[model samples]
Target chain A: MYWEKEIETMDREQLERLQAVRLRETLERAKKSVHYGKRFAEMGLDIGGIRTDADVEKLPLTTKDDLRENWPYGFLACSRDELIRMHSSSGTTGRATVIFHTTRDIGAWTNLLARCMYMAGMRRSDVFQNMMTYGLFTGGLGFHYGAEKIGALVIPAGAGNSKRQIQLMRDFETTAIHIIPSYALHLSTVFTEVGVDPRRDTKLRLAFLGAEPHSEKMRRKIEDLYGFRAFNSYGLSEMNGPGMAFECPEQDGMHIWEDNYIVEIIDPMTLKPVPDGEEGELVTTTLLREGMPILRYRTMDLTRIIPGPCPCGRTHRRIERIKGRTDDMMILKGVNIFPIQIEKKLMEIPGVGTNFVIILDRADYNDSMTVKVEVQKEFFGGDLRQLEALRRRIVEELKSDILITPRVDLVEPDSLPQSEGKAKRVIDNRKD
Target chain B: MISYQLSIFAENKPGRLAAVTRVLAKEKINIRATTISTSDTFGVIHLIVDDPARAEDALTKAGMTVSLSRVLAVVIPDQPGGLDRLTQLLLTENVNINNAYGFVLEGHRKAVFVVSVDQIEKAEALLEKNGFQTLDAEALSAIEPFHYMKY
Candidate 1:
């Protein structure tokens, strides 16, 4: 059940000691780079004063805007020649945030991913089909190397091409897959179109889902449709994608591997650590990354440390699945609404398809939200009254959950806008 | 027997109908009659096409939501009260019409009034019993609206 048994079950105090040593080493490496070097010097930070991982809280939180303003090399902790690979966010919203990795850094990331997979029941005998996009985006290569390290036959079946993905699964007898949650839900329709019930026709037994934060209901829906144990993967490119934290077989919450990184949950407003079980912004500091040392990076992702110990015996503390990114929240009429909240409610209503778009508009000094939901083809019937009722029900349910009635438009399946690999769920047309 | 019409879901925006028509025109499916029912932001385009199954398949492949709905295509007189007579009969039979559209095949002689109703079987029986002629899918698709016009 353990990957690196000694490290996996390391005593909490011992782990903190190891983290302190790594934190110092990381700061040392970070000082070598132009970005962190200047900041550390200007702030008069004494790396020697850091005795334990808890000392990370004293350091300032690094934001993505800092990474962006610094651009390509601001966050690099090592020399340019020391870098072996780099992965970046899409940068659609702003300047792309890039994370570099040295060879040792790559090796470290691979080991963590391998540990994550092993904890989720992946083994050497498994044939892993990685469905994430391969280039630039870290989701593909991170898991690709990790699955390979586990001695699994790695099928780097990149994203999309659902038909070919299915054929390859059957042709290669693939037993495991890594995919985004939305794409996984979309692929189920293609499975039916090709007369392939994944549960019966494919050898798939495990799925690792990530890249975007999806609700627990979304995970269970994919699990039921694919007839496999779906594991929730948590990671951002800043924290070495796909391996930051992962769900064990218990499936209660994701165990953030504290061995490689130190984590904190803080209120976004006060910038102070919240209670252990309270939901707050996740601030992470890389203890192991060498190519780039990000110190107390304000992840902007919102989640909480689960209060109790997990059944899975690894002492690494677990975190509840990411609720939503602080960046993804929208304030409509003074009430803050996360797209995930609407999604969580949408998933509960049967006949609502997986894809939806939240459009915000302003007119006459008042803000209005319109949710365009894709109606499942199976539920659409000849009667207009039934469709109208579905529309009203969607609006009513969303109103009760979101505290405001949003105009719900029932659209055709696959009609909502999508960009890159992830769907552009919200279109904020309101001008300030 | 009840005939079928293709009902398509579309956002209320320019070029939506054009896109639908382009798919039908590309597939060589002729439209016999069409009507649009719209709400605030979206609408449904109900079409009596030459072939509904093929139209549905083509439109769905083109990424449009299309459904086949049971409708009665009754031949009525081309006079002013032709539609009123049919609706009155439907009202008398307690058969509510969800959607209805009509087109004249031959002026002053015959016209077709198509209606989508909840109690379809009952509507068809009442219409037939009341000396009204209901067209089947083949006859409905074969209709040439305004073919009698010399213009």
Candidate 2:
């Protein structure tokens, strides 16, 4: 029943043995590249001496800065002629880190995606609609090839155009779809406006939501609204898009494909491995990548590994849903908070809309946070007292959630900026 | 009783009022009587329009929060004590006026006073019993202020 039954269900001992072999090959491949080769020679590291997964600690950690320093082809282990595709980050902060793939690498990625989708109960009979952005972003094509590999009829619908997305679901009788969780929440309103209840009208039964960090409450919200089992998928462009980990049918935690990558949870500050079940930055080593192998690439995503075995029988260890990216965490008034925590609280409130903007500024020699939320249109019809109550409720809820009382401003529905990809929830204007 | 006033929730910012007016203007909805009530950061614009439902729809579709509230329109003498007499009469009956605005129909003779009270039926009954004439939607829409002016 498994896509790669033997590889996926191999016992822990056997899987580690396989990882050791692949890890050696991966190191060898990295040594052929300019970036890792110089570093390996300069450090006098021996690729052959590294026998087990634990020995991988001997290698220095690779950061995003390392990837950018090398840039376009610095990490290429294969010749340019063998490279078939490349995907780069949006590079909003700086230079984009581009990951290249060979024909064999593409096949492996496709198989992992198919395995992820299959573990989540997708089958050949299902019609899959990919709702993420295509090109550059790995989410679109990553799931695309996987669904197609599983023999599902793939509809690459891309993103935005909510009305047409609904129309496509109706026309094609789409049974499965992949989308960002926030966009899915935003699309539910459009479905209501178009008068087509997604639960009643569409054939959608499964949704693979990822590419942004979200909370469990948000997942339940999508499931309740869309009438589907919303599975959380996790991956980064550095880790081959979205096939890195996925929730099995049990839906407790995402099963990280150990056969494909070496997963390590390390204290982001010390760069040392934390005990299992402890939250820390995820460092991954591409075990099977050919075009470029990133060894011990610090993902900067904070999550914990579930220590117990999954009932799904996949020997691949499971990682908890990403709590928050280290870079996305905000500190206000000596309190550390993530935007997802605020999102979880806001989604719990009935009248608060899905889109919200958190603005952090300096006021009166202290940090001030203002959460600008969009009030649902239905709540606007209520009297002034009701509106006042809603504002007070939001302020109280947020104060209890983030431990800091924020100024709450309720604006009109759809007033906040709607993100087509990667919702920008925070704006820090405090002059550092 | 049929007359409706579009009460809009607006923030106290430049161009907010202009935005609402622009939507009505685009819809070709004529504003009959307008009053703005403001607090520190927010305000409400209560407007008597030629078409209350259509104006509400236009403003709402333009992303402004609007509600159609039924308000009482009473006829009062356009004199120095016109509003005072109305207020004194309401005070005698213990009717509380939440909001009220007036405009003269004919100089020094008659005027129209629009009032929003906590209890509409009681205030209407009290006003009618006192012989103070109240206008319905039909009469209010037909009011032509400054019609006697040459310009």
Candidate 3:
């Protein structure tokens, strides 16, 4: 039942031995790049010292800033002709981090993705509908080839066109779909609007949701709405997106492919490893990548390594669902709040729609937060008093969760901005 | 009495109301009485149309959220205490009016007060028992406030 059965169920001792060999090869490849070669020469570091998996700490961490400073090609370990594909990060914050992949790198990524899909119960008979942006974003192509590898009828339905998406599902009897969590929730309304209940009308049976940090409550919400099993898939573009880790039928935590990536959880402030099962920033090292093998790459995603073995019988280690990115955290009134916390609180309350905006502004020398949420269309006919009561309930729930009371504004449906990719939940206008 | 009102959820934008009207006009649906209640960012347009079912289908098919709710249309004298009299009677019966709007049917003589109540059947029975005239859907749709206007 396992993809790459020998490697997936490899015993701990053999897994570590394999990791050590791959770690040595990865380090050797990393040093071939101009960036790592300069660092090694300046620090007088020896690549031969990385003899075991535990010795990976001897290497300094690679940050996104390093990739940005080097720009287009400083991390290239091969000639331009050897590189087959390049994917750049969505530069929402600043400069985008671009990574090159050789043809072999593409093959390995596709195989890893196929393994993720098979572990989640997807088979060759399943019709996979991919609903992410295709070009630069890794989510689209990453899952595309993987589904194709599994011999599924792949529907390359890139994001947006909600009506058409539903039509496609109905026309092709789409059995499985890969989509972002928020977009899945947003599309649920479109299904209702088009008079097609996804649970009743389509032949969909499985969903792979990822590319955004979401709560368990959100996962259950999607599953309940779609009447199917929604498995959480975790990945970032730096590590070759959407297939780094996947949850099995157990549906507990994502079984990270340890054979491909040596995972580390570290305290962001101390830059030291945290205890097992403790929450910290995720650090990953690509063990088999050829074009650009990033070592000790700080992913900035906050998650803990799940301590025990999964029920799925895979020897690969698992990580808890990502809580929030370190950079995505917001401090208001001296209280730290993650947008996912607010989302969890909102999704639990009935009548509150899927779209919301958290606006942080300054008023009278004090920080103020306003959560503008769209009231579901069914709730719009409610009287003013009922709407006011809903607003107060939302405020109370948010206050209890974030330790600060926020003004709640109930807007009409489709009033807030909709994103086809990652949903932007925060708007911080407070000037530093 | 059964009176139908089309309730539409609208965002607060410059041409949002115009868009609703444009749809109704295109469908040849005549609006008899209307009320707009707005919050900071959104509002609801309650319209008493000539054909409630047709208006609802047209608006919904045009991608607007529309609901047809039963309301009460009470006839009141076009005088100083007409609204107060109707409201005071309903207050005595403990019936609350969620929304109400009125338009003069004849100069200095009569007007129609359209009200949405929590308990539609009970409010209608209470108004009729108190000797107040409640117009049905046919009577409501037949109202033409501009009949006395001279060209």
RMSD of each: 16.5, 16.5, 17.5
Q: Say which prediction, candidate 2 or candidate 3, comes out ahead on DockQ.
A: 3
lDDT of 3 by residue, A1-432 (tens): 787899889988899999999988888888889999999898788889878888888888999889988888888888889999999764222345788999999999999999999988899999999998887779899999999999999999998798999999999999999987767877888888889999999999999987666678879988999999999998877898878999989999998898999999999999999987999999999999999888899988899999977777898888999876767767554334667678888989988987999998864334689999887877666355566678889999888777678999887677687734677889978642
lDDT of 2 at A279: 96
Instruction: Please write out the lDDT profile of model 1 over residues B77-116, one tens digit for every residue.
Output: 8877877898998899788877878777855588888888
lDDT of 2 by residue, B105-130 (tens): 85557888888877888888888888
Candidate 1 local Cα displacement, residue A271, angstroms: 0.4
* Model 2 stretches astray by more than 4 angstroms: A91-93, A329-432, B1-151
**What tens-digit string does per-residue lDDT give for candidate 1 at A357-394?**
99998664346899989888777775566778889999
> If ranked by DockQ, best first, what sequence of candidates would result?
1, 3, 2
TM-score of each: 0.60, 0.60, 0.60
User: What proportion of true contacts does candidate 2 retain?
Assistant: 0.09
Worst 10 residues of 3 chain A by lDDT: A88-97
Q: What is the TM-score of each candidate's chain B when compared with the real chain B?
A: 0.92, 0.89, 0.91
Q: What number of clashing residue pairs does each candidate have, in the order they appear?
A: 0, 0, 0
The better-scoring model by DockQ among 1 and 2 is 1
After aligning candidate 1 to the native by TM-score, how far in Å is the CA of A167 from where it should be? 0.6
Q: Candidate 3 residues B1-151, lDDT tens each?
A: 7688888877777988898899999999888877877777667788888888888999888877677888998888878898889999889889988888877785658878888888888889888998888887778777776432110
